[model samples]
Target: MSVDREPGLRERKKERTRRAISDVAMRLFADRGFDNVTVAEVAEAAEVSLSTVFNYFPTKEDIFFDRQEDVEQEWGEVVRGRKPGESAVAALRRHYFEALERREPRSGIAEGLVTFHRMIEESPALRAREREIGERGVEALARTLAEEAGADPDDITPRVVANQVAGVYGALYNEGRRRLLAGQSVEEAYPFLLRAARRAFDLLENGVGDYCIRPG
Candidate 1:
């Protein structure tokens, strides 16, 4: 909800330090698994004090999911910043297509995506952390939709819509990861992903809106 501003020198420096620490942590996690990598080990690897590492990352899971806060807010941001005449589903569909075209990491089709996802799949703690982040994203999206529609607190429509959208998005993400884990290169898997995404979003837009209605 806050407006963006240019980072100051100190802020930039701090960001650099944070990124360095995270990069170090990720490499350790990749090489030795998340649970095997200790916070003190990460501090030693990154040449930062243990306290400094804790200052930036409250937990080992936090280090692994360093950008989760930004990720949790993304669905709300997409809806809030949609074009004047665009529906929320349409806005999300467009955003997802663009991210796919760009091969963005958030699109689940970036470089090292296989390794990144493999790390998550192998780590129970990371998997649980991922689920927590996903639930937060759904909550944020529901809250944003309710606010935009001026719905009362008791209205469940926004929450239902949010869950629907989140399920679709998660399926799309996992499909991409599944292809990569099956040994398909990004280029090899992209066309399939595009088709799948289009079908999924189209279903969200036109197929499910009136499904299984009971006759009065």
Candidate 2:
């Protein structure tokens, strides 16, 4: 999953080529627009053949989401690898805060992320694909939770929990992105995001049964 530790000449070259291609593709996409460019153009601009591009990325969207699988596994891995006595919500909370502390790009709260965000918003295809990826993430988390809880195949609790957890995270992430795209710098938004994240995760961990009442 990590290429930083990779050794040998061939592996290093392939990594460089992949990075070059991805970088070129993003730059082109950001400059003109995602829909305005084509893979062939990107290949020509990057000086790699179309086949070479395909060898690294399967689709145009793959060019944008170069680490799709890694990103998907990230949340599930946090839950799956949670320490003893750590709830899934707590594990995810810890993972998210770690990203916020480092301002990791995956958190979508990092600086310059709005450029890519704007591109995705402009492209319906990318928007649909991102939504699909979100659903896949939810399913992956649900499966992991089910396995951890030793739930019966017919049980829907894990799946339900997954949806709720994913929804909470999606909301928190969108809120962070909103603040950033509103022209707030990372330094300004991150503190507020951390507070928002803590509150959202707290609701998940503590339950929402009494969150709101009619006050009758």
Candidate 3:
């Protein structure tokens, strides 16, 4: 039992150290913009050596957006873990609404999002990194869809569908973030967000054929 517990204990210690460094770094970044905060300052504030910080985070941006890897893979995991008879879009839509219902940070309905969004918006490096991260998420979802459909290597349908699904989801998330930044309380924005999410997903599910045709 002692031997079995040793590895688990070590892993927990490592995770705790990583979380501490991340928490300290985010505080500094929130207080002073991402670009203004140095990795050395983060290490000093976290009471860890610069080398230790680097051991966990390869770059300063890495420290600021520590959960990025999880974000990149999250969509793929959600689709992969969907229940029997559930389509990928249905699974993702369900997961997203559930997140919003909980007022979770990832759903962009939590407190402190204004500061976080402003920090990212103010930093060019962070904005570029965010775009890269979004692209990776789309790619990850596309790959999963392709695998699930058993598509031919030359088929582009999976990529096309992935972009549309991700696009709708991204638009809804951005709208929520924008509303939060514009000073709306989470409770005030909840109903509108829920309506917007339903309408967006409904468009995707039911298709948007000739909704805005010009009269001849």
What TM-score would each prediction reach against the true structure? 0.91, 0.88, 0.92
If both were scored by lDDT, which would come out higher, candidate 2 or candidate 3? Answer: 3
lDDT of each: 0.87, 0.82, 0.85
State, as a TM-score between 0 and 1, how close model 3 is to the true structure.
0.92
Better of 1 and 2 by TM-score: 1
Measured by TM-score, the strongest candidate is: 3
lDDT of 1 by residue, 27-82 (tens): 99999999899999999999999999999999999999999999999998998887
Ten-residue stretch with the least lDDT total in model 2:
207-216
lDDT of 3 by residue, 1-216 (tens): 999999999999999999999999999999889999898999999999999999999998888789999999998888788776677777788889999999887777787778888898899999889888889999998898888767788988778877887888788888888898888998998899999989988887676222211222
Off by over 4 Å in 3: 208-216
Candidate 2's TM-score: 0.88
Off by over 4 Å in 1: 1-7, 207-216
Best by lDDT: 1
